[model samples]
Target: METTYFTKKDSIVRQIWGKADTILFIFAGAAAEFALNKAVDWLYYTGRLPKDPLGRLFSTVNYAKVIVFAEEKTAFQAIDQMNKIHAKIEENRGFKIPDWAYRDVLFMLIDYSIRAFEALERKLTLHEKEEVFQVFLKVGKGMKIADLPTNFKDWEIQRRSQLQDNFEYSDFTKDLFLQYKKHLGIIRYRLLLEAQILMAPKRIKELLNFRNQSILIAIIPFYRLSRIFKIDYILKELILPKDYKSDIKALDHSAAH
Candidate 1:
């Protein structure tokens, strides 16, 4: 059998990020953070996000997917490029982006990887989960994000504490969310909110007034059934904007190799 780099090399990360559904779920969870975390407001403070929040977020997700899916050397170069971007942002702002905020984005990736995989596929073994964490840990270390935990277990503890300290709804948060709703339209926006509720930490959901039941809790079985009949493609096309169709379609496991 011919094995691509993903199947032969970083198979664990490939499997986690290969599926469109899994990547979309991960994006949804990150979207929740972008809307509610005050520390990340500088992302939108430049007014780029207000003009195109979905496009901005989709670009970030695409960058992440490319880094994970790229070959070893290329992946390192991608990380270096991202770090350079961060340096520029800090240089322009005259202050460093907080270490905690950097960690928040990393933790969000780790947390949502687990959440997305568990919900969309089988539960990951502890070692498999550690593999997921290790990939991002490597990237975080490469970017020189300070004070990342030594292991997945320690990271979980830090993740919980950081959530308590780092996030709050601010004016940026409110405006960004309204932009999301405007861009996604009403029905898709409602679905996005429902998915966020399902994927977010409890504190985040409560803060966002998502204390009510998530529609996704009732839709998972149906979602799985749709996959069997290939109805999920239609579902995705309806939910995602036309401009993003090609980008969303490009998120497959094959794309990783």
Candidate 2:
């Protein structure tokens, strides 16, 4: 599925068949990614540090990019270079980012950057445009928007109403209903913390599963990593218990072996 967070790919499948499963998948993705983003931000701002310079660089850049640019990739790249210097210093400072975590963060940022570029380049549909705007709102951008419900049935009426009153809704109005009618459309979506975090291209239509009255339903993840106590654990757990016991294992395993 294209959308890691209740997005385009799932929406498309829901359209063709009106399947509840696909709709739920999209909502799950959205909520999952949304929560992860927020938690990552909170943990980061709390001054937690990864034992690697690269991780430091990635986290810093991610937070700054949102605050400063609000999804503007142009600005992200501009500061990204400065972050390179920080990366170099981190090595000597006794902090080092692992190759996997480093790669994951970079991949996600790249994916998001590409999406931003495409939307600007290709004139996104009115609803698509609103989705992007809502993304910014979720990430703590300056512009304020309402917190949409994660349920399709509830969101369908609420979000449409918001768009109608808040945005310059013209031809876009019909498009929203059509997408929803297809049963592949989403009223709400989010990101979350989970075993496998799914990520998707920024543009929903770009997902591979696009088709007519489509038979396939899909679920995608931003990506997944094992959970742990974030004060410090140089190694990624990749899998762990849901309760507090697992964190004990994480802390011990993290000790120099």
Q: Report the lDDT of model 1 for residue 1.
A: 57
Worst 10 residues of 1 by lDDT: 2-11
Which pairs clash in the backbone of model 1? none
- Clash counts for all predictions: 0, 35
Off by over 4 Å in 1: 1-10, 253-256
Q: Tell me how candidate 1 scores on lDDT.
A: 0.81
C-alpha lDDT of residue 26 in model 2: 31
Root-mean-square deviation per candidate? 2.5, 19.9
Model 2: per-residue Cα lDDT over 1-257, one tens digit each: 33133223333211311321222233223322222231233223324332222233334443433233222444344345545654665555557433333323322332343233332223345455345334333332221113434333444455334323322223332332243223322221111112112323222222223222212113111111211234223321322212323423422321121
Candidate 2 error regions (>4 Å): 1-81, 88-93, 113-257
Candidate 2 weakest lDDT stretch, 10 residues: 187-196
- Across 115-218, the per-residue lDDT of candidate 1 in tens digits comes to 88887778888888788888889878888999989888998889889888888888878888899889889998888888888888887887787866677888
lDDT score of residue 212 within candidate 1: 60
